[model samples]
Target: MPNAPAADQRRLLDVQALDTRLDQLAHRRRTLPELARIAELESQLADLHTALVTSQTAVADLRRELAKAEADVQQVRDRAARNQARLDAGQGSAKDLQALQHELESLAKRQGDLEEVELEVMERLEAHEAALAEVTAAHTQLVDGKVQVESERDAAFAQIDAEVAGVQSERATAAAGLDAGLTALYDRLRGQLGGQGAAALRGRRCEGCRLELNPLDLDAIKAKPEDAVVRCEECGRILVLLPEDH
Candidate 1:
């Protein structure tokens, strides 16, 4: 492809500037404050959910235990009632009566032990449920906060997108002056070189690489016509020569 005119070649610098602005806008969008806040909140929400699940499980287990303990007490109480009915009828021998009395006492003791277990389980379940409620409420708060943060993040992205659109329009205007082949080369090189394809030759140094050009290469570059676009030896970016460049 033919080289672009000397004046049009400098237009490439304007295009490069616009591209850099676009890159900065993208960076700003990614680093928005809401992005970090959302990330931190998401992590906290996960932990809270885990805690809620654990508390719920404990409460369920304790409920089952309480139910079983209450059932055991009821069974023992029923047996003691039947024994009392037999004693009230007074139809048993003295030996039988004494044995029945001993059995009733044993049943009473077992019932007391079971009732104690039932009360302990009830207290534990109540505490576990209360803890679960607290965690759930906390989780709800975080969820709401995340929603707000996401909304703010979207607004930030929209702002950056608008700026990007404006910069892209400017880039198009700058690119229009260059030959198709020149812009194509620049785009390809920009992709390969971290969003940069050109830099001005400032004094005796290649600004793209911040390197002082060797004497032989520098002399050869100086000998080229003003319209001749050159590539930097150190970094291979299109080297733009300003009028004051030596």
Candidate 2:
């Protein structure tokens, strides 16, 4: 059978109080609303950045295509100009002049077709550039929003950390008065029992689980000597007895 001296048993209630406060602080830290808001903002910012990158890539590709199209049109136009000068100079043989004139006409038709392609590409490039600009602006705004959210979350973390520090100090003082063996037992049982290792026996109930003891269990607990470490038969929690209340 396990037993705690009178002083150790009294400290159990203090330990339980400190442990419960610490648990509440931890739970509050995890459930802060700022944490959820920060997550939502970060998710939105990621999507905006991805959209901006896609838009910028599309604009860049179309600009390159436009550049190549313009160069092709200019190259063909220069060839036609040289052929026109040769025909105008009247220096070629008659057969050669006729061939030069025919070549000029073919170059003119090709230049017209290429100019049409250049116009289409220019329009497409303009649209893409506009889309890129809009996305870039939106992405910039989202980044700023993310920064604000981070600041809020950091501030919340600091506040919670301060509260936790205070509670930890309180718990240290409470734990110092307990017997080493009893405290170790409580720590071990807490790990297995979801953070609660002991409860007071008040009005025939184990306060940890709020279950009322039946006649047999109550009788057994009543038979134990004061200062004897007694566990609840119903829930296996170390049950503390208050002489005045019992």
Candidate 3:
């Protein structure tokens, strides 16, 4: 029902093209591969960190166990040594000497048992330490990988953002000074019609919906003045009638 210069109606196609490109750019930003990859890497890093912490805790507990085992062995050994020295001085009765000898035997056996416990704890501590070292190294490698991927992701973001900026500027220029009513109608239709407000009528086809206009509709559209605005019956989009060379 509105009117615009024939040239302005055709220029609206260029504006539509720019808008479509902008939409594509926005979709590209949302579906960037780096975003998914980064999320995956972060999840792996979180699991690896938990494993590393668990390994470290096991090593710490083993170390404490080894220390207590060593203290127990040393205490038994010190007591046996003092008992031997007193027995050698021969300053007590036979009963006392006999009792001291029996006690020496008990102390020697206690020392042997304690030494076995110490050795077992030492072996366990060594194994846990080795496991901790392996986990630490793996965690460090994962962290490095995450950092590298993050850098790549940032570079990708910068590139896409720059392209979006360029496309937006072009769109602004293309839409500038367009017929106010036409532009307003186009925007409202675009909001309702999946980002396409206008499309060309090539032959009988409405490019917006990819459907052919009926002969009656096509004839009616063709009868309109060159400056008269028309909409496609199939899609409800402004139909720009470009001049056919043939």
lDDT (C-alpha, whole model) for all candidates: 0.86, 0.83, 0.87
> How would the candidate models be sorted by lDDT, starting from the highest?
3, 1, 2
Give a tens-digit lDDT track for model 3, residues 1-246. 899877888889998998898898788878888788878878988998898889889888888888899889889888888888989998599898889899999999999998998998889888888988988898888788878888887888899889988988988888888889888888898999999999999999989999998888888888889888898887899999988811
Most accurate candidate by TM-score = 3
Error of 1 at 64 (Å): 1.5
Q: List the residue pairs that clash in candidate 1.
A: none
**Candidate whose lDDT is highest:** 3
Candidate 3 is scored at a TM of 0.88
Candidate ranking (TM-score, best to worst): 3, 2, 1
Worst 10 residues of 3 by lDDT: 237-246
Candidate 1, 58-151: lDDT as tens digits = 8888888888888888999999999989977876998898888999899888888888888888888888889989988999999999999999
User: Model 2 over residues 6-25: C-alpha lDDT tens digits?
Assistant: 56776787788878888887
- The per-prediction tally of clashing pairs is 0, 0, 0
For model 3, the stretches where C-alpha displacement exceeds 4 angstroms are 88-94
